[model samples]
Structure formats: structure tokens, C-alpha cells
Target: MTERLLAFLILCLVAGAPFGAALMWTGNLILDFVFFYPLFMSGLWTFGGLYYWLHWERFWPWSPDAPPPTLKGTPWISILIPCHNEAEHGADTVLSALNQRYPHVEVIAIDDGSTDDTGAMLDRLADTHARLRVIHLARNQGKAMALRMGALAARSEYLVCIDGDAILHRDAAVYLAAPLVDHPRVGAVTGNPRVRTRSTLIGRVQVGEFSSIVGLIKRTQRVYGQVFTVSGVVAAFRRGALDRVGYWSLDMVTEDIDISWKLQRDHWSIFFEPRALCWILMPETLRGLWKQRLRWAQGGAEVFLKNLPGIRAWRHRRLWPMALEYCVSTIWAFALALSMALWTTGLFVALPGHIQVETLMPPAFTGMALAAACLLQFCISVFIDHRYEHGLFRALYWVIWYPLAYWLIGLLTTLYGFPRVMLRRHRARARWNSPDRGIKAPTS
Candidate 1:
């Protein structure tokens, strides 16, 4: 609790930085920053995505749905599925991995001390398939530890890790491992995650979120020469790279972000592979969505805080852009939050002359500019990804809610997560509590 208190205190200091400057400068500057940062980021991502498409993605020779060009010799690869109470989706997920079009692949399923029949079911699947192996943990260890064990036991140089509930595309294995096999310096390849839980409005919007926001940002980051993080749900790694970085940090709440930083800091390259598609479920309800996003926000904060000390080095110069962006975004979250609070207080009581209530929102012209930028970004990202996402245009209506959803969600999560991350001590092992994997349709 003391840790939490310190975290809150630190957050107040960080948030207060803008307001403190308001006394020297005008409060208008803070409001302008709050309004313009999102607009600027949207524009950057749109242009970056367009650049990647024109120069890189559009010219790829292989079909998205077919196997990539065959190599001289098919090197062996291992698919790692770490599960925690995933009985309902385990079998189908394993089957998809086993059925990969790539010929030389082995499937390893780790049942991370599931209370349900997850272990028994994995064993049952292993009995029928010679290439499938099952590892049972005596108790619940987190996803990072489970993955660490699986990677250590993997018999191949290339490894693809997916969530227990995700269905890997038939040709995903080859597309993922191809980068590692072809490029000696490439450390990891993050795949495209398509949402399969579209039974609800929230789930439907996330599908577009993956394309417009998640997918676009990755392409942009890769173009910038550093990735913020790999898609944790499905990413392929080079065993040598993992070994060098000491594998995933067991203490991190989000291992993906931590490992991404580790590899990049060590001068290993991470690639974004659009053809390696993985279908996965997402939260269909608001409560579930909030929990999932909260965890993600906390994980991001943890990574930022843990890696804060290393950025001063001259050799880590490439990481400065990403680090500065994170700092600005965190400060922006607090500034926006403060603006809302002051605006609400103004409704009941008058605020000072310098802090006019009208400043709470962008002027009509600025609003239009932001809207135009967001629309361009959405259009470009969705258009580029349309081939990978069938019937994607139909989701355009749902995506209209995306910009607002992301803004509000991003603001709240950062405010709530940053402090907790600041005060928290590292744990011996990060524990896993099963997440909301969305509502699966009934299978007759």
C-alpha cells in the first residue's frame, strides 16, 4: 500500500509539471498540447503506414493465404502454446498448429497449472500426434515462465509462440520463420492478429482496432527502425536471440514488451510480418475489455520504468524517439485528465480568467483538423490491410468509434497504471490469472 501511495505521489508530480508551467506560461499551451499530440501521432502513423505499403508491403511476392517461397532446406521450427485454464479452446488451437502447411514443425503445449482439465486434454492430444509434446507445470506459473521452459526445451532454432486460444493460420508458421531463416540479424517476427469474436459490438470494434491502430503502429515503428513491442498473442523468435537476452523476464507483468526492448537494446532486429496471420478471441464486454486494457497499460508502464535508466547511453540513441514519445503520452494523459477535472469544477464554480472553460475543447477548426487526420489514418490502414482482413470494409462503421475509444481508454489506463508501476517491487515470479477470452459460439 505504501508503494501505491508513492506511485500516486509521483503521478501527481508528473501531472503537475504542466500545471506548474501554466503559472509561468499561459494555460492555453497545456490545452493546445493535449489537443495536438494525438493529431500529430495520427498523422505520423498514417504517413508511416503509407510509406511501408508503397516501399515494402505491396511488393511482397508470396500470397497472404499461401505458403511463403520454399527455402533450400526446411529447417525445423517449434510452436509454443502456453495455457492457463484454456480447456474450451485448447484442442482446436493445438490442431491448427499441428496442421501448419510447413512440413518440419513440432508443437509444444504447456499447461500452466490449470485447475481445469487443460493438462489432461493436452496429454490426450499428444497421444495421437507424434510431433506434439505436452509439458505440465505442478502449479500455476505465469506465461513468461511457461514460455521460458518451452523455449529451453524446444528442439529447433526457430520458435513461434501463440496464446492457448489463438488459431494459427495454416501458412503462418512458414511466414513467421522465414524472416529468421533468411536474415541472420532478425531476432523476432510479430504476426497479424485478426479478431474472431465478433458476436458483440466491442469485439467487432477491436477487429478494426487491430488493423487501424495496432497493425499500423507496428508498420510505422518498423519503418522508424525500432518496434515498441511485438504482438504477445503470436510472435516468432530466434532461439539464439532469446538465449542472448536471457529469454523473457519472468518478473514482468507483460513479458512481450520487456523482451522486445531486451532484443532491440542488444542490437537484434525485430520484424513485422503481415502475412503471418493468427486468429484470436478478444473481450466482448466492457468489464472484460477494461481489465484486459488495464493489464496492457500496466505492462507498458512497467517496461518503460524498467528501461528508463539505459536510454542515456550513446549506443542506445535509436531508442530515444520511442522513449520520448512514451513520456509525452504519459504526460498528455495526465494533462487531459486535469483538464476534465478543472472543466467539471468550472461547471459548479468559476475558474480563473486564464483558465477559461472553452479551453477544455479544441476550437472548431482544430477539431476538424484532428478529425481529418484520424480519418486519413483509418482509411489508409484499413485499405492496406483489407486483403488480410476479409470483409474489412463492413467494419468501417464500427471503426468510427475507435478513435474516441482509444483516446478515452488510453487516458484512463495511463492515469491508473503509471503510479502503481512506479511504487511496485519486482516479484519472484509473475503469476497468471486467466483473462476474458471473449464468448465462443456454441459448437454442435
Candidate 2:
């Protein structure tokens, strides 16, 4: 029975890949027709253009007209900052948390065995700030482990995890916690992360991508109460929920994703609050950006494989939508790679007739229209994001190159991730390599 079950599972995977590929091809073809037809492409482009248009208003920061909520008697919040060789920015992150307008907050900066001056900095920060505390690890551990330790040590009812490189806005904590006041079922709330450095072209492109893809999609998902992953840069969780989920899983590279999945399994609703913003420094160079995205892609694959069974077994009707979105998305990566191969090969094949270039013009025109529409979509997102960040000149320049860069990056990372997941070759423990920090030997 065991052998039979294993064979059946392999067969199912084999069958699913081709079926998924066909579905993706069909979906793309339909999209092409709807967004590229000469008569309809413009209209569809205008309508599809609304995603970015809506994103602007949807993700704009909280209005001053709307008064801040009166804290429900000041719920004690334990702010967790997982630091790994972030000595340069450690003090800044801690200071940001300590400077929060919200009273009754405990800030815990976990030094995850940094070889640098991070521990000493944390200690110095703790000396001045009464609310600040520090945890020291003897050996280097990944962010997941650091977060788990911080969560376990939290004395408050609520926990807020912020990356060491992230700077929280004054109202960030208050905005993140306000949701819990009304929604008892909410287990976690993700704050918006804005790009702090748009000085480089790569940073500018990422800023646009974040606004259009991550920011917009997350808001839509939030509307449905089905946010997939909480931003690791800044997110708040109920201590009870973290305890119930056994804290962050150290096995996955993307601990944020793993915890979100676990929370969903435990029937906890995750929310995306655009009102709360955390400023983060984006990768300034292409090499740095590539490494950052590659880690995310690999981590996504790791999480999907680790939680596939539980996700499939979920009983809620909403779980199907979530699962389908995730599974189909991963499978579509392979399909896209395959389609690119076909398109490349097709260019070399020739027919033995008078080649009417006009015959191919329709598809070419369709492709161009689709591309233009996609660019317009990005422009809309940038406009919305710029309302808060104000990098209009840089954003407009980056928009032209973003689509191609995004596609190529996705393709390369997904290709690299697919085989690693399939062969079960990834380390169960999350790797602590900081891709944003240039790959260099750390000096003590």
C-alpha cells in the first residue's frame, strides 16, 4: 500500500504539470486576445488600467481627517527586532521602536550572534531606553530562530516583528494594532513597506514593482481576508496566535510565509493595513537585487513543498482559492519557461510559402498592446505609491524597464527554484546569508 501510494503521488504530479501548463497557456492566450485586439486592447487596457488606478487610493496612508483610535487601555506590545550583523542600523531600528508615539511598548532587539558591534549597540540602546531590552545568542542563527526566541520572551499580549533595517513611522505601531480592536479573529496584520532608497535605478524599479505588484495585490487579498504572506519588514501578531502556531518555523527560508500558512491552518485571519508604513532600504544594485529575489523565490518554493499536504487538506471553502492560486502560480512558472522555449524555437522555423508578414502582424501588434497596457498598469501603481514616497521622476524613468526586468528575474529564479524543490535539495534550516549586503567576509 505504501509503494502504491508513492507511485500514485508521483503519477499525480506528472499529470498535474502538463494539465497546469495547458491551463496557463490557455489563460495567457485569452489574456492576449482581451488585452491586444486592436479594437478591444485599448478599452481593455483602459479597464485593466484600473488596477493601478485603484491601488493609488486603496493603499494611500491614513487620512488626517480620520482621527486616530483611542488605544484600548494601552495593550502592552513587545516589539521584536531580529538582528544578524546589522550593527550599522541596529541602533536606528531600536531608536525607531523606542520613539513610538504609542505608550506601554516593550522593544526587544535579539542579537542573532552578529560578529559585529550589534550586541554592544543593543546594550547601549537598552541603557538609555527603559522599554528597550536585548537578547544575545552565542552562535549565528537564522532570522526565524531569532524571531522565535524574541516571541517566546515577549511579556506583552501582542508582538510586533520588525526587520533590523526597517524604520517604523511614528504611527506605525498604533495603526497596526488598531485592527485588532475591531476584528477579534485577526491573528496578524502586515504594514506597508516603502522603499527608503530610490537613489539607484534598481531601487527605483523595485519601488514601482512593490507599489504595483506587492502593494496592490496584497490590498486586494486583504479585501477578501486572504492575505497570503505578511511583510517581514513590519508585521504584528497576537502573542497567543504565535504561541498556538509554535512561533516561527526555522526550517523555511521565508519564515513569514511559513507562519502565515500556519496561522491560516489554525483559522486565523491575516490583514494588510496600508495605513501603517515601514520604510526600508531596497537593494541599490542589480546584483544585490537579483540575490534578494532569488532567495525569496527559493523560499517560496520551500514553503509550498513543506505545507502542500496541509494546504490540500484544508476544509474551508476559501482555502481552495488560496491553494489554487499558489499551486497554479508555481506550476505556471514551469509553463512560462516552456512557452519561452517554444517561442524562441518558433522564430527559427520557416514555412515554404510567400511569407506574408501581415499574417504575423496581428499577434505582434497584440503583444505590443499587451505590453503597453502592462506598462500603463505600472504607471498607475507608481502614481499611487508616489503619493506617499514622492519619487516621481525616478519612478517614471524606472517604469520603462520594470516589466522586462521583472519577467526575466521571475523566470531565472523560478527556474532555479523548481529543481531544488523537486529534488528536495534545499536545507531545512533557513540560511542567514544577507543578499542585500554585498557578499563579503564579515570582519569581527
Error of 2 at 208 (Å): 0.8
Clashing pairs in 1: none
lDDT of 2 at 120: 90
Candidate 2 residues 309-411, lDDT tens each? 5666537556566666655555445555544544454577752222211122236666676567666666666655565565554666676677668767876
Minimal lDDT window, size 10, model 1: 435-444
Give the Cα lDDT of each candidate.
Answer: 0.87, 0.70
Reference-based TM-score of each model: 0.95, 0.83
Residue pairs with backbone atoms closer than 3 Å in model 2 (clashes):
none
| Candidate 1 error regions (>4 Å) | 1-13, 426-428, 441-444
lDDT of model 2 at position 344 = 53
Model 1 / residue 248 / CA error / Å: 0.9
* Backbone clash numbers for all candidates listed: 0, 0
Q: Which parts of model 2 are misplaced by more than 4 Å?
A: 1-67, 343-362, 437-444
Query: What TM-score does candidate 2 get on C-alpha atoms?
Result: 0.83
* Top candidate by TM-score: 1
* Residue lDDT tens for model 1, 359-394: 486878889999999888878988899878668888
